[model samples]
Target: MAWDPAVYSAFAQPRLRPALDLMARIEPADAARVVDLGCGTGNVTRLLKERWAAADVVGVDSSPEMLATARGDGGGVRYLQADAAAWAENGGAVDILFSNAALHWLGDHRTLFPRLLGRVRPGGVLAVQMPHNHYAASHAVMAEAAAAGPWSEVLSPLAARFPVGEPSFYYDLLAGGSSHLDIWETEYLHVLEGDNPVVAWTRGTALRPLMDAVDGAWATGFLAEYARRIQAAYPPRPDGRTLFPFRRLFMVARKG
Candidate 1:
C-alpha cells in the first residue's frame, strides 16, 4: 500500500510522543551502527542520528513516498528502500535496532522478535513501539463498518488480522534472548480538534489498506458509513475537542 506523508504527518505531534517516550528509555551509549527499521518518513530516524551522533544511522522503509520525504530532510542519514521484514532478516547486525510505530504490521512475532533480538550485537539494544489499540473503538468501528457494507467482500480480508499481541506475549518472546528487557504499555488520551478526527487519524494508518482496495462510488459510500459510525463512537467533548485514547506497546531489550 502507498503511504501519504501529508496524511500520516497530519498528527505528527501525537504520533511522535510514543517514539519520544520509547527513546527516553533506551540506555545504549556510543553505538556504532544504528538502523531505524521501518522508519517511515525518517522523522524519528533523524532524532536517532542526533542521539547517536557518532553512529552510522540508516533509515529503512518500503514506501518510496515516505523515503522521498525522509531523504528530502537530509540529516546525514542514509535511507534504504526495502521490505521491513526482509531487512529485519538480512540487515547486518547493529549496535541499535530501533523501530517506532512499525513491526506490528507484520505477523508471526513469535519468530520475529527473537530473530530481531539476534540481529543486535552483544550488549546492543533492540527497541520498538507499536499501536496496541486493536480492541479500542477506533479500530473496532472500522471492522464494523467494513462488514456492514457492499465493500465488505474486498475490505473484510484486510481487516481480518490485527498483528499486535499483548504485553505478556512479547515479554515471553524476548525474555530469553536479552540480558535486560523492559516492556510496558501506555495509553495516551490525545485531544484532537476538528470534525471526525478519528477517521482522519485512521486514514493515515489502519484505514489506508481498505481505502486502497476500492474506488468510485463504493469508496465514497464506505467512507461515509465509517465516518458516521466513528463520529458516534468518539463524540466531541463539551469543549469541542475529541479525546482519543490510543494505547501503545513499548519494549527495550539489550541482547546478552
Candidate 2:
C-alpha cells in the first residue's frame, strides 16, 4: 500500500518538532545548498528553505510516494526519489546535510555517518536526528508478544532487525573525526491527544514494515496487542493526554 500523506501528516507533524528545533541551531549564513536526507513528504525541507531563503534546498527519499506528496510551489525545494545512503556514498556534496527522524531506518550508523560526513564540504555541517526507542516497552513488547503467538515462526525473524541504538554510540562514531562534532540526546514530552495516539504514531513511521509483512487479520491482532502493551507502559494522564517521552539522538558535525 502506498503511503497516505494525509494519514501520516496528522501524526508525523507533531513528532517532527524536535527536528525543526535542531534546524534552528544551524547558521543561516552558512546554508547555501541544503539537502534533506530521508525527507519524508518534504516537510523538513520546506522548513529549511524558510529558515534560509537564499539557499537552494533539496529533499531526497527512497519512497516515491512520499516524494510525490512533497511537491510544492512554496520553498522552491526540489524533491528527488533516491537512496540517501547511496547518495551520500556517491559524494553528493552539500553545504548542509540535514536529516530529521529518518536515519534510524537506514541502519548501521557507524558506516552511514562516515559516508554522510564525507558528503559535507569542508567546513560544512551534517546534522541528524533519530528516535531511540527500540528498547522501550512500546517496541520491546511487540516482539515479545508476537514471538509468543502463532505468528512467531515468521515474526520472530523480522523482530531481530529493529533499528535502534544508544545516543553514545553515535557520539563515539563522530568523535576524533577530522571535523568538529556535537552530539546529544533529548526526550520530548509530547502531549498527544487521541484514544490511540501510540497507534497513530506508529502508523506514520515504525509500523510500515510490519504492515507490509502481514495480512489484515494478523496486522490488526498485532496492533491491538501492541497498543495494550504501550498503554500499560505509558498511561494517559487525567487530562486525556499521554506524556509520550520520545528520546532522540542529535548530531551536528562540521568538517574541518
Candidate 3:
C-alpha cells in the first residue's frame, strides 16, 4: 500500500500546527546545516528554510511517494530518499535535526536516539515531535474492533503492539547525555471540521499500516467497524464538529 501524500497533506497541515509552533522556537542563526527527518512533502522543511535563509536544508524520508511530492526548487533545500535512522548512523552531521509527526513510526528509539544525537554537531539542536496517541480511543478502537469476528485471527497477534511511548521513556533516553534536553508532552484539542473528521484524520496516518496488513475486503470491513467504534469513543459535538484531543510528545536536545 502506497502512501497518499496528497491525502496526508490535506489533514497534516491543520493537525500539525503544534509541531510548527515548536519548530518556530529555534533561533536560525544558531543553525548552519539543517535536516528535516521524515519530512513528508517538505511542509516543515520549507519553514526551516524560511527561518534560516542561508543554511543548507535537506529533507530526508524513506517513502519515494512522499519525496516525490516534496518541492525541490527551494534553492538551498534538497530532498533525499533515505532512512532517517540509517542516515544518522552514517554520521550525517548537521547543526539542527528537525522532525515532526514522524518518530512514532520508528518505535524503537533506544538506539535511534543516541545515533541521532551523535550526528548533531556541538552546540546543535535536535527538535522532534511525535503523536503519543497509541492508547487513545481512536487507536484502542482498532485493536478492540479487530479482535472480533474474522479479523481476530490476523489482528490478535499484533493487538499488543502500539506505535507510541510515554514521556518518561524519552526522558530516560536523554538522561546523562551532555546535551541540554527539554522533553514534554501535550494534548491538543483540535476542533476538527467535517462529518467524520476523526476517521479522516486517522485514515491518513495511523490507519495506513493496518490497511496494508489486511486484504481488500477485510480492509473495508476493518475500517467500517473501526469507524463505528471511534464514533462512540469520540462522539460528534452539537455543532457538527468533533473535539479531537490529540496527545503528542516533544523533545529538544542541544549537543554541548
Q: Quick one: best TM-score, which candidate?
A: 1
Q: Give the top-scoring candidate (lDDT).
A: 1
lDDT computed for candidate 1: 0.93
lDDT (C-alpha, whole model) for all candidates = 0.93, 0.77, 0.80
Pitting candidate 1 against candidate 2, the one with the higher TM-score is 1
**Per-residue accuracy of model 1 over 167-186 as CA lDDT, tens digit each:** 89999999998899999999
All-Cα superposition RMSD per candidate: 0.8, 2.0, 1.8
Candidate 3 lDDT (Cα, 0 to 1): 0.80
Q: Could you tell which candidate, 2 or 3, scores higher by TM-score?
A: 3
- Judge candidate 2 against the unseen true structure and give its global Cα lDDT, from 0 to 1: 0.77
lDDT of 3 by residue, 118-168 (tens): 888888888888888888888788788788658778865565576666767
Q: What is the TM-score of each candidate against the true structure?
A: 0.98, 0.91, 0.93
Per-residue lDDT of 107 in model 3: 52
Steric overlap count per candidate? 0, 0, 0
